[model samples]
Target: MQVALFTILSSLTGGHVRILETAYRYPRRPTFLIPRNYYVKLLNMLDTYYEGRFRDFIENNTVELPPMEITHFYAYPKYIYDAMNRIKGDLSYFDLFYVPHEHIGMMMLLKGVGVKWTALLQLTPVIGALDVDLPMNPIRLMSLNLRLNGMGYIGDKLFEYLIAKAVLSGETVLSVSKSIPYEMRLMGLRARVKVLDPGIGIDEACFSCGDKDIDLVFFGRLRREKGVFDFIRVLNVLRRRMRMRPRALIMGASDDETPRLVKARLRELGLSGLVDVKVNLTRRELLSNLARARVFVYPTRLDSIGLVVIEALAHGIPVITYDIPAMRLNYRTRAVLRVPFRDINSMALVTAKLLSDEEYREGLANEGLRFVRRFDWVNVALREWEELGKIASEESKAPETKVANVIKAISIA
Candidate 1:
């Protein structure tokens, strides 16, 4: 079965791209659609996965796929219209289209275009607010309310579109979080929904237990949403209350200007000397840093699935994060400690306690290691591929031809 993967909006640091990269091991090659410049950089980043016959790419917005050849297209609903046009005006050649829930516009459009596709759900903040009916943290609730109010008319149309798509598309829905399937159904979704947690590769040999000298560590995008600044504030409070020069490490990829902003904030908080910041480290470098850290702190205000949290757990590092609904619903385990949203004092206290209490920290670390076993990338790839095989078998009539190349449009925002 020939399959194509296209994401209209691609992020160098995003989880969706990483998931696609992991799925590259499947027997049938899948083409990627992304920007040409990013394609090279992304290939270099995935050097470990390069096996000579890597999937091909088509520069962004180029409708190059032959409608008579490819069987199915697994799309992340960023640029659906362009992709549909790429099929040489033959939607039937693409038997199944996979859509992420966040792309409500694309979902609605596909239904109108009379195409076959599945909805891939990632319970983001908007869905959490609309579906789960949980008491959100004050800040997150406020932000959600503001966004909803701001998008009043457009939001209504989008949901109407999703409901229509749900009724029209008799395809299955794939979700990463357990709560998403239930939420989608609650919203009158008619399609079958399956929960498949996207997994990460784990090699115990790659990750090591190093000296726990680093008191606190946070990795991933150095953006405000990831709680980069909030973490710095928490460190300041922890230093004052504990009255010790606690060491902190902050690492991840960021825009050219973000590093300057972060440094300015660090200096303003008098944390420049106490905190060490780095960006764009390779996989080994990131894991190495994770191994050295005693505690992993992620104060992200919003996240569908915190992969970094699991990575920290795999390294047997205790984590402290905000009590967001997604984290509480999906991974509320004894393995990671949670503080109320925006409560820097509580976050600081927990970090200090973990640093002081070795036994308690180790206990949580052990539990984390056990909890993370379920997220092994092998299990993820198998389940995902199994579903793909079933779909391909049903569409065996699809003609065999050279897979389409990838085109990436959006850059880092």
Candidate 2:
């Protein structure tokens, strides 16, 4: 049963990364994104607010499969069909249980299974925590950009609230950020929240593209928030201050508004000739570009924490980013110097100091390689799995006990 859950979550789930039928992530990276739409802003909003109020039903409501001994793969027609066909069994088989709000299908699937004692893992803030204040997601108004199309916009706060109700009620909630847990409480979920941020997956084994190292690399939507403008600013700074390790900025961008602006900024800065921008590169190629950079510039927002930072560190390059929770958590092993986010002068100063100092760059690299160690997919995978295991096992004890046990397990993990 445990194997089935792992296999299903590991494969066929949403996101840019997908595990193959063999249960090994297609490329072997330890991470995966939830299935998505271009409305990244809206998605971020829904992840937190669309609280699955029904989710915390793991204890007496259902049965569970132990961590090691379950098998059977079925990519049935859909969640509703699959639930009707497979999940109609007794609760005793599963001593513990879980439910990760992996997809709309899975969300609907739980209602039909007539099962209980399940914990569902979720990523993002918008979905379940609708009541929390969040900046408006611009993506909701995206269609307004296309001139000819009559199609208007998507995303509404009212709709977000409805989604949150389905997500927040989970018997146990698992998220990738510390903020998720905090948000859960602000919304009145007095207990039962866990944060198992899947740090950079074991990248070397998965993203190892013929070992050639380059000068610099950057990835993400080409937007100001990600600091591509800052990257350009620092490039100019390098021209003025840092001489050694002359850079060739290889930027990989996702299809988003940010990249278009980034390109425009690069042109405005007159570094168009200096920086090589690739808007859409295959995964292998993206890694290949990363392999080339000696150091990666990730001068993003102070609050933002994405898994990309860890992926870069895993590639043996130190990062120069604004000090934030994401980088702070990986402080010891990752090569990074947290600076004030968006301050061009500080960014430039740090860029000059670090890039010009070869000894420091090397130190940063060594430290980064070490820092990302704790996040190795294999190293942290079991701990995450066990967190779910304990939640499932202990939830059967009692509601207050269930919440207390799961929270304790998370602290230990």
Candidate 3:
């Protein structure tokens, strides 16, 4: 069985890309379709982090697939439509088309082409846009509009429409965490979802016990949705209220102006001496730096699996994060301490306790080390590969029938 993978590649690194890179190491390598321009960027990333695994894939598989240009987020549906139309005749060569993420554009493309496809629902923008937990005030509404380019309402509705259409189209949906399916159902969208066990993984080297001098560390993308501002607020509370001068590290890639905004906020809050910010470190560099951090403070509201959280656990670091659905569902261990969402005071108090009590901190760190062993990358990747093979095998049994039914269902929707 042959499978084609459609994914978005970017310069900014994340858990989604890490999952794809791991899957590429399986015995059955799927043909990857990404934007033509980012091919070299991907190659460079692989060479830097994976020890030239991309070259190994070519040498072992003896296949160099042509690149596809479909990176524009809003215009991707049209781009994929045109690209698939041009290669409609060649689409029959593969048994299945697999998408790493549940991209609405890819759903539209697959519907138009009448193909058997599966998408991993990492996280949906619909949940972020319409979070009832977050009050919808004027400032929040304006921020949403700015992020969605002044079409916040339309974009939310469109996401709902495409997601419903995809579900009705009979495409298999896999979720990285149970929170996503719950969110979808809360939004009144019934989807048949399979939750992947240990949905995210970390390198074996991430497990270590060493001299941890850094008091706090926050990793992942430097964005507001990731609770970067909340991180700062917690720091402010720590200094002013608790009178603790804890050393903090903010390490991640900057996809927008958030880094500059973060710097400005740091200056304003007088945290320039307490906090150090680093951006765009390679995987190896991140792990090296992460090993020295005593506690991981992630206030993220945007992550589905919180891969960095797992990495922190793997590194024997106790974590304090927001009590979001994803965190409550996945990381419910003694190793991870949870505080109320947006509760800076509570987060600060927890951080201070963890820092002051070395015995308690070490206990949590030991628990974290024990819990993270099950999330080995090889095991997670193998399970996903088996699922994909099952998907492909089922499709190959009656390709024409499945394709026709999908197309019919999509048309009716």
Candidate 4:
């Protein structure tokens, strides 16, 4: 079986492709299939996908892809949304050849080139799959029922309409969240789904990689939806509760109104004195910061999975995130506690519990360390390869590398 880790021209896709390539050791190195034109077209298309939701971001951000020939619509997300949208909605866009067709072409290319089966790494954001813009219960209701019986017939009518309309979104194989794979059956898609946890690559060897003896650290973008303002609130609560102020680091770049809103909120909350916000750092710099922190806090309302969470867990630091599926699905936190999504009080309460209970917090840190080790990119990568093998009817032919052996080898040698 041959595998391809895919990405659009955006940071979301680009980052994922890099993770799979660098972390997973395929029996033989797989080719990095990229075509800038496809991404260009995708950005151009997203410029119009969801009533300007994605399109707005495309126009606002400077989408700089690596100098590589990324595949055509294969990496384009809007193509998938549009095809599925037009078909499900049975919109007039059937006049245009679209997403599924795009997936078919890409898949055909792989097959035509003598590749048995190809793996597509699809990055599923919490906001997108679960619709984070709306209230949780409402969104959850939509997602929950969207996973039921008639939805397949409903989804299929859309899928068939899109395929018939010639809007072929190139998505032959789906690399999605664990739940979405099951949900797709309800939607009546025949394609196979491989649910792999998505986390940024974590290196365990460096002393600074997972070392946790510092005050506090927060890596990832500074955005409003990420609950940066709420973090400030939590900080304020901490100061009042502990009487000792904790120094915090905020690292990453932002493109939306979130940066401005978050900054304004910090000043409003009088948190400028406690927080040092930095934009953009090298991977090493980010890891170094993680190693120095006692805890990592991200109370986001929308994140399918935060790479920073795993990064923190790897360094043996506890994390505090809004309770959500992405976090629950991706990592088991010994040191992480979740509050309800967007609940500032609950966020502070749970976080304070960890910070106050030295023994409990330390125990969690140990659990987090063990948890992240299971989700090493090597394991995820190999698992994805196995999924492709199953699709190719070569599951038995694939070699099994014992997890225990691999773990000892990485930790020791």
lDDT of each: 0.61, 0.47, 0.71, 0.50
352-391: candidate 4 lDDT, tens digit per residue: 6776777887898888877766555566566655555565
- TM agreement with the true structure for every prediction: 0.75, 0.60, 0.85, 0.62
Question: Over 4 Å off in model 2, which ranges?
Answer: 2-114, 117-122, 127-155, 158-170, 177-179, 182-191, 197-200, 206-214, 221-225, 236-246, 256-261, 302-305, 330-334, 394-413
Please give the distance, in angstroms, between residue 96's alpha carbon in candidate 2 and its true position after superposition: 8.1
Model 1 per-residue lDDT tens digits across residues 155-273: 43443433444433455556666655544444444556666765344544434688878989988788776788888888888877678688889998776677789889889878899
RMSD of each: 7.8, 12.3, 4.8, 13.8
Mark the regions of model 4 whose C-alpha exceeds 4 Å error after superposition: 1-6, 12-24, 36-127, 131-176, 182-191, 197-201, 205-214, 239-244, 255-260, 392-413
List candidate 1 stretches off by more than 4 Å: 35-41, 44-79, 89-93, 123-171, 182-192, 197-206, 388-413
lDDT of 3 at 11: 56
lDDT, candidate 2, 159-237, per-residue tens: 4333334434554655555654654444343335667655225545434433434555666555555556667777777
- Candidate 3 lDDT, tens digit per residue, 182-265? 656544455567788878777677876567889999988887778888899999999998899999999887757888899999
Order the candidates by lDDT, highest first.
3, 1, 4, 2
